[model samples]
Target: MTVEIRVSRSPGERRVALLRDGVLAGYRVERPARPDGVGDTLRGRVVSRLPALAGGFVALPGGESGFLPESECEGRRLPPEGTILTLRVTRAAQSGKGLRISARVKQRPSGPLALLERGPDQALRWAAAHPAAPLVVDDPAELARLRAALGPRATGGAAFDDALESEADSLALPETPLPGGGRLIISPLPALTAVDVDSGGADPREANRQALPELTRQIVLRDLAGPILLDLAGLSLKARGALEPAIRSALVGDGLVQALGFGPLGLFEMKRARIHPPLHEVLADRPLARGLALLRLAAREAAAAPHRVLALSAPAPVLDAIRALPGALEEFAARAGRPLVLRDASLEEVSDA
Candidate 1:
């Protein structure tokens, strides 16, 4: 019904268009010229922090990383050497580097976080708009010091009445599996997106052909990504007729939807009209890795048998999940009946698992 478009004037800022139901609904653009990077948080482990560039790998965090410029690296605690943390995507991922940033949240009285760590134009606008109240400060430590400053406005809650009304709505939303067995994780963005189908999870439906089209619809509506690329395997010749219209209907609030049938490699392509980074990209700080991982490595030192030892290499929080993997791995390793030893990756970090 109502469509809005936002564009920035300077370079470095992204140009975004948000669409719903095959129609234009929103637009946003980035202008490097803008100064506004306050509260953008992304969780990732520092893969390789290169002092030369001042940044490293975050598991291709957001498909890339950039220089964590000395200016942004404000504190010793801020994504210190090799810390698995929530950094901001301040710039395009480096040529061999990736988007780099120190995350902090920037907010105004209004909802919908406008800028995270650095976006000058947006910050000024937010400040001007909320003159009556104190504009949110950007200092990560200082900001964290003020917990209830915003009170009920914290992003997670809604009015009790509206919440009750939403229960049914929330329940109605489907929980479908992804191409792999893992759950389909959707945070919805306002920008275009590129997803990598690295591994699978638990659900069997993830293997279904129908899941492809459905994923497209849910993704657009949730992340608001326009010009999407679905790169999962299989589905080279499945019928689009089974799902297009539903996807079209979902875009009712956005704008035009155009998609080419699945390509030779099974990558389905589609685009929506939008102007913001799809929610997922902004939020996808960390990859979906089970804290406790199975280390079925082939080796000269195959302890007690065939495969290898199962290293419980996660921190305390994920120990439970790691502990649960042994049974599954044991079943898989049973044919050879090899002894699976649980080793820790970090010789120094001793955790519960």
Candidate 2:
């Protein structure tokens, strides 16, 4: 088996893609300045309690808050508002939702909040552990960091350009086309992610059989978590029986596979360990994409007025992201042979950018 790693460096974010036999197997985005606090432990105070939902809110030291389920209370009395407690993040915040925390702290944490290594680095170590699989990074600096982090297994000089950027974009697509004229529609609900399997005029069993491997790869690649409902088209008892084994075979060696069974109404139910939000929500939760869009616009506008001071305006979040990247704006301005000015404005001015 051949494994290839592609690392793409952009301002404020670094994206990693893993390929197995030329197929996209894994994808991750890391924003060093702003990390997803998946494994972080925070000292928090109970801010709200809801007995009906069996969950409540905990406010951390930095004014950030997370949802605390009753199960995370560990049989202790439900703390009233303003009660102090320690919590570990179960799932990072995403799509405007707060972090998911629990009372169970696996290790002693440091600071008011403690962070663990990002997912890409964790997966890089996993790849490096296999001696034969070569690791590649596009940036020399990134390659050096990985080598230091994972010994000599890391290597440099992989090609990454707009085509690879497009390939990375495809990983987060909602509708995934399958071989043999089938498709999988992945929908992220408030509770869990739902994947609808469509045979697309092909036999349901055959399509499902073909889709499982790719679907399994996507599950790991996208880092989708929590309960997953696979709605197989025209599922029968016999076909369902066949699929259980097939699904098991597909998921073999993939990390953190959980309960697998058919739920009410024959929906194939499965779960994956969720440490962080999936790629879609990760990108959505940050202003990196918006900052990139604004840079693209700056590129275009710079060409039109090479010597003029180009003014770029965006919301506070986007502006913060743009400025977070060292030398990015200055480099662009230098290339344009002009000065660039940044402004804070509503997204209306920056949406198309």
Query: Best by TM-score, which number?
Result: 2
Per-structure clash totals for the candidates: 78, 0
lDDT of 1 by residue, 195-227 (tens): 433225433223444454545555543444446
| Candidate 1 residue spans exceeding 4 A from truth | 1-238, 254-268, 272-353
Ten contiguous residues with the weakest lDDT in model 1: 4-13
Instruction: Report how far residue 148 has shifted in candidate 1, in Å.
Output: 11
Question: Could you say which candidate leads in lDDT?
Answer: 2
